[model samples]
Target chain A: MSNEETAGSKPSEKVIELRLPSRLGYERVAMDAASSLARRMGFEGDRIAALKTAVSEAVTNAIEHGNQHNETMKVVVLLTVRDDELIVSVTDQGSKSIDEAYVSRVPNISEAMQKDDKGGWGIWLIRELMDEVEFTKAPGGGNQVRMVIHLER
Target chain B: MTTTRQHIIEISFPSEFGYEVIAREAIATFARCVGFDRDRIDDLKTAVSEACINAIEHGNKKVHGLTIDIVGVYDGNMLQIDIADQGIQQYQVAGAPATIEEKIAGKAPARGMGLLLMTQLADEAHFLPDTNGTRGNRFRLIWRERVETLEPEH
Candidate 1:
């Protein structure tokens, strides 16, 4: 089966889309969906929470980093069910690139999580939670992020 | 014969504070059972709260009459918690997933970092959808034993 196809009948595949606003209000729904889906897929309790948090942080970064917290620009998240795995892709219509140097330098989470260090950490948090991650340019002038977390064996 | 230890909590709310409260309570209960230290409890609470907040704010989109289902399992040294939410159409967003590493390393823009943090905090992580011949959505959280500590002096 292809990457997008879920492990069921052709029509069984499901997808969800949401608009991530700058305010925290819009992000909640996606987070909830992520948590529930994680749990149902047989992820242990702690891991489920982590995946949800990861989705939140990524969407936030898409808003903060990609969109620069701009209200007009919409932050988009696509949650798809593939065979044996859940694929969640978030995209933002912004020109800014992710700060790879800042995220990679602080390999240790304790260091990246330092209270005083507020410059960049959201992206770091997202990387720590999910299993696979990818970054690509969107069709228009924007960025796309696809993160994959597998269902338990 | 041995009996399994199971704890369950069901929460439903339309505001951010509700998510925070339930997350804190769930973490506290889990920490106490696992003998987690104060610092460890704090970490668990923060991580759980972040997850809950994301659910309420992003997944459910602050919709009323919606509920988040949470379950905790204590398997000897291991502690597992499950949080589930029904799918709501209003909260769904659209776009392709981005590459997290490239963005973080300056090779590209940031993406998919939240999964990294949760995985870092917890020993394991996974993602699933409810499509059980039904129309709603469900997710989960899985982790190993929490860091334990001695009780503080009065």
Candidate 2:
């Protein structure tokens, strides 16, 4: 969202916030919310699908790793709809801090296939699907991932 | 976020028109995961949309900075939704709603249709007490599961 917009220039920016318990199936709420907003903004079918996938991976990561399956912890998903882009930020109330080195490393397919658990592709998938992605610590002490997808007019 | 088996979700959005669709979509997906059939999900969406509209138009008076809060919980046999709004104008605890013929004959305005729809679509829809240390008007909607589903208990 921009800091300044002339009055009566465009649709007012909106924000939808969803706070879900740190559970697996609850992530669908975030995904569906984002998909609805993106579709309303005229995002294409493929982009909406991509947005849902990216949102699912992000929320699933928040539940599985960030919150470590502790149902007491909550995963907060903020969807900000601007005139030109949709910004989604997923924050988890986790005690674990995110490692910077691990965030940027690209996983090799061969290496991942050799391991029993072929996971760890979430961050990479989000990075690939979203137009812009950033990971930072929440101001209130949690891990947050903010992803932005541009609306092609 | 309690330790009990109930699955609860809390959502809040700016008090504006058109955002209710997003809330409807979110809850529809939740209802599906909680084992509601297609017809029931559609009814839930309509009920949620009407309630959110009432929250925005009446409870918050369409104030831009104000927000509407929705909390949804699904226990084993019941799905309950609580839609709360900042009490700009207290909801009138009045008598029964107007009849359809009264509105058709221009005897009553069509303003009460939203509430009527809410009560009809949801199994139970009623307003919570506006007092007792609470700052807003809270409306609650409950839908009970008629037949047990195979979905695992939360």
Candidate 3:
């Protein structure tokens, strides 16, 4: 599942790229790919599950919101493994600026859940699970959500 | 009650995680047709997906032979989506931690995030019991278009 741009790239820094159709069925594909990469990096049990959930939430947001399930649109995920951290970035074809809508800080889960609100948890979960979460405009266009997880070794 | 400004699209599919894409696509398309901006459409799609996922996983408990029914109603500049599952169980909805101290000490619960996402993405999101007293859980998501002006008047 890992994509190596350079066959002999440094072991500590390798990048994996995945392109998937902006469809819900493909979400599982992204999750599996992320999980496999995380597992290969020595993440176990709860950490692996957290990575999978975080990737799933990011891909789900890209497909359901950013790409709007348009067949022509694609969700691009890049996983970069560093010596001490893993960085995952999800890019979608939508041009809307998420800066205004995105809440920079962790939401008050206790208060939010009590209101029985139906939405706004995906980003929160991503932020909570990953060591660092960021939103930025993609290179060619569209939006990108980048998340980082610190390695335990 | 029907009005000239109302356009309704209803779909029924097995209660499965895979079918959530269909519901998301349907709502996105409908929102686009109603002249909503790209940002607004994306918000609606996110909200719809959260609701649909909740229905499939929590409402139906991923049970076989059950179905999730979704209805999208576009009334003028506002769009409302209703996702229903044929399950009688109710979920406990609690509020997020009120202070930074509480959040730092609290662990995020997996089960409740979907509902929280739905409310944040949509303008309004709430649950309603089956009007006819049927055995099901219904979630409603609403999004309204922001009014825009062409130019400042002299």
Best by lDDT: 2
Calculate DockQ per candidate and list them. Answer: 0.01, 0.47, 0.02
* Higher-lDDT candidate of 1 and 2: 2
Question: On a 0 to 100 scale, what is the lDDT of residue A118 in model 1?
Answer: 55
Candidate 1 chain A — worst ten consecutive residues by lDDT sum?
A1-10
Determine the TM-score of chain B of model 3: 0.82
Model 1 achieves a DockQ score of 0.01
- Using TM-score as the measure, name the better of candidate 1 and candidate 2: 2
- Global local distance difference test of model 2: 0.88
RMSD of each: 20.5, 4.8, 19.4
* Best-first order by DockQ: 2, 3, 1
* Worst window of 10 by summed lDDT in candidate 3 chain B: B92-101
> Per-residue lDDT for A150 in model 3?
84
Q: Interface RMSD of the predictions, in order shown?
A: 18.5, 5.0, 15.8
Per-residue lDDT tens digits for candidate 1, residues A1-153, read 112332222543444444444434445546766675555456688877887888877777776778876665767776665557778888889897765575455456577577676556566677778888877888876878889987777
Predicted structure 1: lDDT: 0.58
Model 2, B68: alpha-carbon shift in Å? 1.1
